[model samples]
Target chain A: MTTLTHPKYGAIWFTLVVLLGISLLGPLTGSTAFVLLLAFGIAVVKAGMVAAWFMHLAVERRLIWFLMITALALMAVLFFGVAPDVMRDQGQNWGALAAGKN
Target chain B: MIDLLLKNASRSGVEIDKLFDLITFLVGFWFLLAEAVLFGLVFRFHRSRSPRALYVSGEEKHQKRWIAVPHVLVLLCDVVIIAGTMLVWSHVKQQLPPADAVVRIGSQQWAWVFTLPGPDGVFDTPDDIARVNELHVRSGAVYHFELTAQDVIHCFSVPAFRLKQDAVPGRLIKGWFAALEPGRYDIQCAEMCGIGHGLMAASLYVEEKEQHARWLQENAAPPRELVAFRFPNP
Candidate 1:
């Protein structure tokens, strides 16, 4: 039996904590775009760290890597595909345009 | 059969119905075919008075092809469905047609409040018309709504219009539809909010322009205690 240990684990934990702290301070900036970008970035980094280190994907075989990449690509496609509809300018008075047509 | 499924009152409702019919037909065909094949295989491969049974691990080239072919076909079906759905979704949701009116819907534990632009035709104004549990709009006109929830999450759904949107406490959602026919439709709270969720029902009246104008003139009065509610920080 063998036990594996890495000195980088402590560094990764520190980085995750720092990222979380930054995300917590995101709302104070009062900039929605900035907050959203920072939060999502932190989430992605944290998720990547977990998948690479905790889940041992860094040492996984080529087949596992291919499957993971395919899954991620599909998720990105789905998100981008649906984002256009939900992220429209709601403040614009579309009714005024319709009234002009009439 | 189509009429039995919520009456289509909006122009876009027709498109939605067409998409739904296409999906139903494809799914029904696939379901029947798959079930028939499953039953046929079960009967054909049933164990009878046989001396021995053949053991196959499906690792052979021929066996692998059988699995791969079906998998490819299933992937093709998925691609077709996704392509068709994205087209309709982009049309209905991404592209906003000219709207004749826009209203704000505020939902709480057990009630729905609709805010219509006043004579000035703008919301967040002192003159804006706010009604409880009654939404009035003109037929043959495109209408947009801004949805928000005061407390818990709720879903504003009108079956006849084929529209549903979530009202989140800290987020504003937009939804729109155009009514081609004039009638009274039911507005339901599709998401459960609280114990009073069952009572969270409203009425949507779509009438002729003249009739709708008259009704608005008679009932469009802003409540005295119209508090400006702001979205809470998450």
Candidate 2:
């Protein structure tokens, strides 16, 4: 047996709306770093709700789960491969990124 | 190579052109070879010549060589390009020659202001020559430019010189170039800053020694009218 969601579509949609409002209003508190972190946390919750209830990922079979995981793993490999060049503080012939050039 | 058609007037542009030519030759060779092989195969295997179809599973060692050989060759080409690029980068950027003259380049919305050392060859003095959208330099002299942006990020690009540098706001970026010949060149902003980015262009005048000295001496006198530089209260 395999599972990827809930049948309560209306309840999930309402919860998503509430999370959106909270995330938008969270910036007014003036603690930008803390509020942004909280907003991201809310976004993860909302995303999970959408996937499990709206998109029905929770009810999908094991094959669908394997496909999704493979896609995510490939994306991670791409990120790690490119992150070094993008985030390099000091690299050979990086005259533009050297100290005091910023 | 396009270098034969497009003129390169700077010291480092010569080295860059060599690298460009090498890459062009290698890539062009591979491109032509691949295309010829593709069309040749198509013509050789035309349906009229043979009614039967042959299956290619690409599992055999012979079939595998098709992918492996080209893959290794392309990687070798990549290595050559990377090595040449690093050498050019090192020669053009990492090593800085002592400046014979220094120019201060200030970029803002829709305009560029250049401050060159006048007859005295000293900045911030009465002899300093400041002009808007016009830069004058003497040929055969190494000039280091201090580039900065007043409003937003802008790039100083000279196509003939193959020189391009970004002018970042609140930062002083130093770069150098030497004009080998005396001529006028187009100076343009390569970075998009505002609505007037396209119009943000200037002229670089590289003059002969005697001509440059004459121009320097002529512009030394104080002007009857002064142009004021002001900033609004933020």
Candidate 3:
């Protein structure tokens, strides 16, 4: 029996594993920002790999690519559009501002 | 039209409304256009006159343009909206501007507990002022809040301030907003936590600078005893 094979699967899998390891070790840095960045970055890379290789999106039809791009674009609109109101800074009070000096 | 949507009390609230208006206009235009096209096609290709309809599969290169052109326009619209929104997002959410006041909000199933640093400007101390369901701040002053939930997840939302953050159990979320006007605003639990989720509401009083200071002083907790009274350490 013949098993299906892909030329880049092994390399992609290895990279994903390495990324997972890095993300797991990210918490050891004891920096919240660093850990968040590393985890998110790795997740994005891993997602891209899965989509490209496992999902066969790398060689899919143009229509499929178009649909995927459209979906992603819509998701971006949803995320960014709602973010402004959610993220606005509430200005500082006089007491708190003065306290920061110490 | 802006006032019809919601009351804008914060400096950022105005910007949020503007963004909302822009999005509404963009989407409204597309909605009308799509509806018009749908109605037009229905009448233009009516069954009475033409027995054979033009069945274009859109698989051919020439036929694909019918699908591609509209999709390209949609993509262009998406790009414009995303770019515009992201600029506002980075300004509001990504960059945490220096805040003059900090409040820690702990949410439970049916209540919000706000902890304000005392005169010494340190939290988790004996002098820390803790209030339930009421938060007071100075108008025009920037205030940052750290939010967390004691049990179920809750959202700390002040519609007037145009700010909302989820208070997840064991996770601290930070949010900030500045009230432009001195008024009492309602704080709603945007995320449903439990049976009494709808009842979980609070009031935010944005007062004058002088009034805020007086309120703080009046509400400040008395200093705690330095030594804990126990059974002589067992």
Candidate 4:
């Protein structure tokens, strides 16, 4: 990977500037849901840029790519495994005790 | 001394202390043994002044069965540990508390606000008492806790209870714990939130059920005057 002064750095800076501008104004003028989605999208782009350019993960060999892909697949499975439990209703005391039901 | 960060013999916060101790001892011993073996081999088989070095393990079958067996054992232990911990974690997260007591905990930058539900089923009402930092709970009863954060992310951790959950901004996190003993416990902020993160702490006050009720009744009385009392101008 080249140094920060490379031409690619300018593109990165421009993208960051656009993201910053949108981040600053989007939440103030838009719904929270929209702002969250926009933030998440920008974060994905930023992470991809950092990994490919700065981390040099893009230039790795095929074996390293295979290992990375396997790790990502495992992470996806783990995330899906936990998503259901995390979304489940934990405990209800107030709702029950309020009705004199419990 | 080896278990410097370990809890005492008594059970309080989380009941997984024994399991944790066993796992810690096993893992710690294995690492020390492995490192010792590696260093011993390196030093014993060093090519000092001798020009020729032994090339005994060129053939796969010539490798020591002891080393190969230990390697397989380590791999098996790794898989077993991961599977076992995953099962325990899932079990802990899935189990629901009895539908009796519930407390609302609001975690801000430097303190925790604990709100107990009143007769009206709402928290922090005129009839309910708001406790800062310290939470009073009854022993042997399962208390369902609802967690909320005022600022950034912070984790509610009770080392004795072996229970922890993260409080996120704009989102509510929930976790439950039932303690066997009625004693004071430390509430730690496990997440590295910000500068004052370390200072953000709370105390858990567990008392007998009747005493807890009396304390609640004494502290939670409604304010005497709802309307302003003023003298009429003559």
Candidate No. with top TM-score: 2
Error of 4 at B189 (Å): 2.0
Question: Whose TM-score is higher: candidate 1's or candidate 4's?
Answer: 1
lDDT of 3 by residue, B16-100 (tens): 7888888888888989999999999888878986668887777999988888998998898888889879977866776667899
Question: How are the candidates ranked when ordered by TM-score, highest leading?
Answer: 2, 1, 3, 4
The numbered model that scores best in lDDT is 2
lDDT of each: 0.79, 0.81, 0.78, 0.68
Q: Residues B175-234, candidate 2: write the lDDT tens digits.
A: 889998999999999999999999998999999999999988998753434235321111
Ranking by lDDT: 2, 1, 3, 4
Q: Evaluate every candidate with DockQ and list the scores.
A: 0.07, 0.07, 0.04, 0.04
- Candidate 2's docking class is incorrect
What candidate 3 keeps of the native contacts, as a fraction, is: 0.00
Residue-wise lDDT of candidate 1 within B38-131, one digit each (tens)?
Answer: 9887777777644467899999999999889978877887788888889888767777777789988889988898888866777766677888
- Model 4 ranges off by over 4 Å: A1-102, B1-15, B46-52, B57-59, B64-68, B119-125, B222-234
Chain A TM-score of model 1 comes to 0.67
Candidate 4 per-residue C-alpha lDDT over A7-88 given as tens digits, one digit per residue, 9 for 90 to 100? 4767877887788787767788669898888888887787777776666667656787688789999999999898665444
Summing lDDT over every window of 10 consecutive residues in candidate 4 chain B, give the lowest-scoring window.
B225-234
Candidate 2 Cα errors over 4 Å, as ranges: A1-102, B221-234
State which candidate has the highest DockQ.
2
